[model samples]
Target: MAKKKALTNVELCKGCRLCVGACPVGAIEALMQVNKKGYEIIRVDEDKCIGCGNCYTMCPDYVFSIEEV
Candidate 1:
């Protein structure tokens, strides 16, 4: 079976930090950097992520994508 991973679209992020807290494995974190819209973006640690889709569900901005790896 193929493995799965979570991907983030920084441009669509709104600095809400919802995904950061929603991550069950603590795979998501907020960066000091900001996007073009000036919203703080988040990064997912692929090594730590479990592809549970929690971040995708919690985000109001639709910033997350789950894909096979």
Candidate 2:
């Protein structure tokens, strides 16, 4: 299998909430409050994510990415 790039780096996020709408699986969830950049950080809910890479494309900050199987 190929290695997968984990969707991390909430610090770099701007909390535009663009990725949330793009994810079909609803795997991404808003974290505690907001980051230093004033954007609501998100985390991948492994069970819901299908590795569709939808959020990956929507994220302008390149916050999201696909991972290996």
| Residue-level error in angstroms, candidate 1, position 51 | 0.6
Using all chains and alpha carbons, the TM-scores for the candidates as numbered come to 0.95, 0.77
Looking at model 1, residue 45 earns an lDDT score of: 94
**Candidate 1 residue 3 C-alpha distance from true site, Å:** 1.4
Q: For this target, which candidate reaches the highest lDDT against the unseen true structure?
A: 1
lDDT of 1 by residue, 1-69 (tens): 888889989999999998888888999999999999998899999999989899989989989989998
Pairing residues by index, what is the TM-score of model 2? 0.77
> Against the true structure, whose TM-score is highest?
1
Clashes of 1: 0
Candidate 2: worst-modelled 10 consecutive residues by lDDT: 1-10
